[model samples]
Target chain A: MRKMEFAEAIESALKHAMTNDPDIFLMGEDVHTLRINLLAQFGKERVISTSISESAFLGAGVTAAMAGLRPIIEIMLIDFIGVAIDALLNHASKILTFSGGKWNVPLVVRTSCGGGYGDGGQHEQSLWGWLAHIPGLHVVVPSNPSDAGQLLLSAIESDHPVIYLEHKLLADYWLDYMGTGGRENVSFDVPEKGAIGEVPEKWESLPIGKANILREGDDITLISLGVSVHRCLEAANILSEDEISVEVLDLRWVSPLDKEAIITSVSKTKRVIVVDEDYMRFGLSGEIAAILAEENISPIQFGRVCTEHTIPFNRHLEDNVLPNVNRILALARKFKS
Target chain B: MTLMREKTILELYEAMYTSRYLEKIVTQLWEKGNIYGEMHLGIGEEAIIAGVLSHLIPGDAISTDHRSTPPFVMRGVDIESLLLEFLGHPKGLCSGLGGHMHLFCKELLLTSSGIVGSSGPSAVGFALATKYQKTKNIAVAFFGEGSMNQGMLLESLNLASSLNLPVLFICKDNNWAITTRSNEVTGGVLLDRVRGFGIEAREVDGSDCMAVWQAVETAIPRLRKRNPAPYFIQASCTHNEGHFLGDPLLRFHRSPKKELGAVTGPLTKSVLHYKGGRLDKRISSVSNVLALIAKARAQLSFSNDPIRRLEKTQTHLKDQFAQIKLKVEKKINSISERVLNLVQEEASL
Candidate 1:
């Protein structure tokens, strides 16, 4: 077992993914070790950087997808994704259906999200929800280092446009989520593909469209994703003794939603709750209820945990809205028996 | 030079004529209360689009302003979708959210945006990708003369020049940024401004669609240079119609200098010739298409459930929107009480 921080795990997984697939390349801000190391390990042709042109490169990534190359487009900050919405929404998200599925965008957009280090307004927003609403797009929010590595590899390998959300807070966080570096990666002079066995007895394919039940309970089904999922897990543990066994579902992939898991869980639990790190109105929770109703699941109790439009900072305040054990516990207590 | 084959020239003229017809129809639609929002028309400026897009090869990327329909139509945008878009139907190109300003054809990479100069840096981004990937695909950014002053446009020039990226910057110099003339926005010509940034720049008569096309086509070769900056083409033309149908024509008629009208007048002659149907059934053919679009638009407006049909087209889109919206907003749900406290307790961004 090797110790790996989120960034290093990402490095390890990226190195392996590139070695396995000759088409994966990196494009975004910053190019020292992350790109150079990949180029030296893979080849100059496989790793690269851009000149702060998010929209163009994202569009280029879409273009490359048409040529059968998988591209990893990076946004220096999650807030910067706004600059390339045209590429993401207009081009990448609709290329498949727009071309009637003749062109599949094998694209990966990696971005760092959340508030930290007093960066102020524009730099500190967690706008993953903005990306989630786009159709023909897949989204992943890796909670820790190991998951970051594995998910990044999977995203780069996948045939759809995937927005891999990495929390700014996890840049230093560590975990062991990798598998054996496949034979193709042996030439890349790198560490193993950082999969240190899936979390205890859990399976790790973590399909891009499935929602996993992190905690099983009889009272309420608490839905969440990314960093909030972990917070909900903590809340479930805290509220365990209120005779409220809150069922926690980690909606790992936001698009191509796993409605089956959500609907089935809500049917059994009856008390439905959602913790979204995006806006409330016209966001995921509302859409999930709308979907549940269409699926003939009537009387699904609805609740959401989301952020307001105000720029987030001051850890204490952000902690309140970004979903911590306290809020989830409170919601669990209020909604569950 | 406006030299071209007879058929090609006629096609170009026809496209421009169609744009003129479209502009008139849009104005009539707005006046008739069929259109929902404000729309910019390229009534007198059809040549800029018809000219530049005529020479665009496959895989050439281009960006446009709200007043950029003629070029897209010339470049093969589905007529059905184009009219539906103007009518604000779900069948419209952008599912109707884009309205008039947001028309985009992903396949052709023709984008229309309301945000001025925003596509500048984005054009640079595409050029960077193609250069890195070794693709021959070239991107074009079409903006108004006023956009020449936008910071991003300047930044894009530097970025493309520095990176030696392949991009064509086409300025549809309609001589007026609304009421103000081009001279007022920049000290010298827009082409000079682009060249000052070390980009290859040229000026063309925008009304001559064939000339505009030739200029851009010629510029593409220079963009292939190792140290190529973005090639800038200035299409000097006129906006025969007002900014939007809601805008008063009399205000513009009396606002600009009288000399401007004689030089940049509306295509009244073209429409006048059309009234005499026998002069050119070719003009009559365009009207026939317009009549069809008008009928489709009327049905689209009367239909209460077109959006429902659009939603059905993307059946999973709503749910998918919700799921991602949930992920994006999860923190907000947790933070509402905190935000309320902050407003009450701190009131800071």
Candidate 2:
């Protein structure tokens, strides 16, 4: 039993994979610790860092994936992923099917998302709302340190393009899981938690394309993701006092939409509200509404409380652009009709 | 021209001849309206692909731009499948999904990308993979001289050398990257700059297959291991044809030897009289390969043909198209009556 950090957990997975498989490589920006690069410690032949050409390097990662190498590409900042959408969406997403099922792009795109402290709007956008809309991509967002490590492993081993979004807020968060070297050196064994600090004991891998039902209630279902998930849970607890009994669904994946779970929840609740950290238009909330409409399930009261479409500048504006516990609580009460 | 063992020399000549032949076929297929999308013809350059590829085994991988058929074919790609891909038929390499820019054969470990210089960093990935797997195979990359100007390629070179992965960087210095000369693109002999980054480097006469092979043989073995990075070789080949096939072949340079009165150095005179020679033998074999392609196309008439496989795919795509049907149905009233009737049928029947 030991303690570790989310960044260290990701490093552990990469280090373990690199140690085990010579074909596995680490590339991106600042993958290695300041003084030591990934290649310096793991030998220069295995680890690589590219020059800020996200599209080119991402395409290179796709090219490598198609060429039988499971390449892990680190897109340092999640905000920068917009620059590499062509490589990710057009090429990486289609490689498996494009090869007539004869090939698979076992590629992992690791990037940082969401706001933490003063990173500002350009650096702190959560792409889950956008990427979840893509068909061939598997979007994984880990709310805590432990799950960050486990989900990173799952994405690394996946035969498809897995977008691992590590929120900057959870960056320095400790992985207080069992089976780790908590000494000066980082540890490997972290009890996989779906959320930060402490989660349920039996929580292993919370299955891809399935929403994690954080709270069960018949009144209304608040669907949300990223850092806002914790706030939704808190809001659910607060709403429990009013006996509103809000069902909180942590949409682990965005793109696949977990249509079945969503339909079942929306059908029973009859009132739905989506609290997402992303913008309103064409985002996760919009997609969920579109899906509900597609499935012919029109809830009596429905609304999506999202951050502003504009960029987050300072501390206060950044806070406003992202959802909070009070916001989730306030949004949940509006469906009392 | 015959330097070493007869078999070795013949391999070099055959590889080059096949590169030239297959490249010509791909170009013709594009010109004949068989293939869709942009095709970067390797018509004016053959030695580079044939030269470096001759040393690689099945496990090794190679990366290319649009003009990568030479390495793809010489590395034992299914010519019929390639031609089918060119024809945009179901039997093609990627089942006509990838088209010209995205030619990939996992069996041969050859991948052609639509984006230029994109393959450089990817070459590093495969080489990184091969090194991690502890396999003896290396990753070969063939890019134009202009690609040297791309930061991604340079980054890959640094990454390759940093990891010491088995990666043979073959810069097909054709002197023209879509009309940009080598001088205009790169400052120095690109190989020198590559060496400055701590990667071993060499420059060879790209027109001579043997010369390019000589450089690759030296670099390949060193690359097939980890720790120190693999060496690089720049083969300077001249593009006789335009950027692509129809672009027109620019008259440049002269024949290798002086022409005599009667025989007049056969390469400078009639090429057919030298038929049945090694080069001609391989070029003629391409026709036989094309014959096999025709046989595969003939199978299209049968139910087993790949084109019929679309029926199976239609079921998988039912959902993707289901919305299209509903949208068309919803939009029918907004359009003309005949157009509405043609497009808005609820059922294909």
Candidate 3:
């Protein structure tokens, strides 16, 4: 095992997958800029940098996957996915069913979401719920460096389209450039406790539809994913000092949600609070709530902490809109009462 | 045109005839309500499809738009399964999940979508895969002139040129986007639009099979080179059925008096009303309407059927033409019968 950063883990996974599978290639706008070493190693034929044509490139990636090549496409920002949503929603997501299960698109679309450095509304969004709603898509959000590497490998190996969202704050590049803003009061250090972990040196793949119990307790349960998982852990630690034993569940895959794990955790705790960075309406938190309600596992108290239905901008306003440890703690305290 | 061997010409004619006959049968099926949904037949664009696809070798891939039957037929995709698919049978090509608009054959490397301009990106992707595999295979994209205005298609054109991918973009221009005339909405010359991307662009009479065949024959060698580049062809054809079967335009032309009677009284009242426009302006508007009707009538009378044109050019092979026609009809009839019987059995079950 070796200590690895989140971004380094992603790059290492791509390198290992491409080395093993000759049919795998990478293409997108400015992908060459991020992995110049990949361009050098794989040559220009495999590491293709395309024009600023998201619809064409993404559509091409979908078709290339159908034509017996695995393509890893990058859509610089998750918010820009609207420009090429038809390629994913209509084509990649429906190709298998449309072709009567004859053609399976084995492609990975990796994009960054979340905002802390004031990238504005257009650049900041965690729309995993929007993607998970699609029928044939697999949405995977990894919280730490270890799962980041392993889940990505699993995504590449799957015979369906996978939307892998990486939060900006947990990225290695964002961590390195945190202080570049020169705002002395704004402490932009990596806030997550387990963002960096001992990733296996040899290539490994984590299953796609499983949740991990990050922390164990019985008094109350905090369920979340992506960066919110880290915030929940932080909130759990703070609540522990108040004689509150908090259980934190990190839901790695959002689409094929680990409902069994969620039920097991919520059943054990009997009091649950869901912390989600996505919007409150029609999002992951509501889905979890619906699952619990359907199962008739009525907890003593249930609550939710999610982003408001608004685009995040202005550092203070973005912080207020996004779910932070303070809000998770407050919600946990309310559930505890 | 003379450089093409007689055997090759006969082969092209056979493919064209087969596609035309198959679409005719499909039209009858649709009329009988055996096939459901909108049927967009490649009736008039047969020359463009057969002309180009006849030269395709193994490993070649094709991406096509909604009017994809001719290309798939010419490429030798199983006719029985294709008919079964059109009939919505469980044993169909896509197991009745996808109608005629969406068909795919994994072994043939052929895909078609109802999306207007998706063929561009799909073909570029296939070409990109071929380049990575270091193969001499090429990819062809078949779209209509209406798709030229689509941003994705334009982006695909620029991308193919910039990346030097081996793709052939075939624009089957029937001068119509559904009911609207394409030239009214399109800007500038299409050949110029393609040439602006630094790719070689050509125009061919889609009614003449030999002309399209020769143009593609000259372009294929350049595409097979190590540093392959993209090519574009704008083939001017006609939609013999107007756009889709039972098109109102064709219905109006077929019985003008009956069709226009309902609108004529209201139209005259609007023209005579003083509140709307001046006398001469309204009169000129009526004259423009008359001129459009005349043009439509003229188009209907003209024969741009590629199969008939090819038959006209093959007068010396009258006996061979008769033989080919008989064989094609027999084959189509047998496949249609088998498909209908299977669908009937499935329905009864």
* Best by the lDDT measure: 3
Error of 3 at B71 (Å): 0.9
In the order shown, the candidates' DockQ scores are 0.01, 0.01, 0.01
lDDT of 1 by residue, A113-166 (tens): 764222233445666666778777888877655576767766876888998877
Local accuracy by lDDT, each model: 0.62, 0.62, 0.80
Candidate 3: residue A51 lDDT (0-100): 50
Query: Interface RMSD of every candidate?
Result: 27.2, 25.8, 26.5
Model 2 Cα lDDT, one tens digit per residue, A145-221 = 55666667677777888888877656643221100101223222122332335322222344567777878889888
Instruction: State which candidate, 1 or 3, has the greater lDDT.
Output: 3
lDDT of 3 by residue, B86-177 (tens): 77566668665455777788899999876668899999999999999999999999999878877789989999999999999999988776
TM-score of 2: 0.46
- B1-349 per-residue lDDT for model 1 (tens digits): 4456655655555566555555555566555544443457776567677766676678777777667676677777765566656654455565544556667788887876665576788678778877887767778887887667655778888888887888888777754544333453356656666777888788887656566667866876677656555688887665544345433322223343642353232223323332222334433433432333233222113122212222344454566434544543453333333433433454244
lDDT of 1 at B28: 61
- Measured with C-alpha atoms, the lDDT of residue B282 in candidate 3 is 51
The CAPRI quality class of candidate 1 comes to incorrect
- The CAPRI class of candidate 2 is incorrect
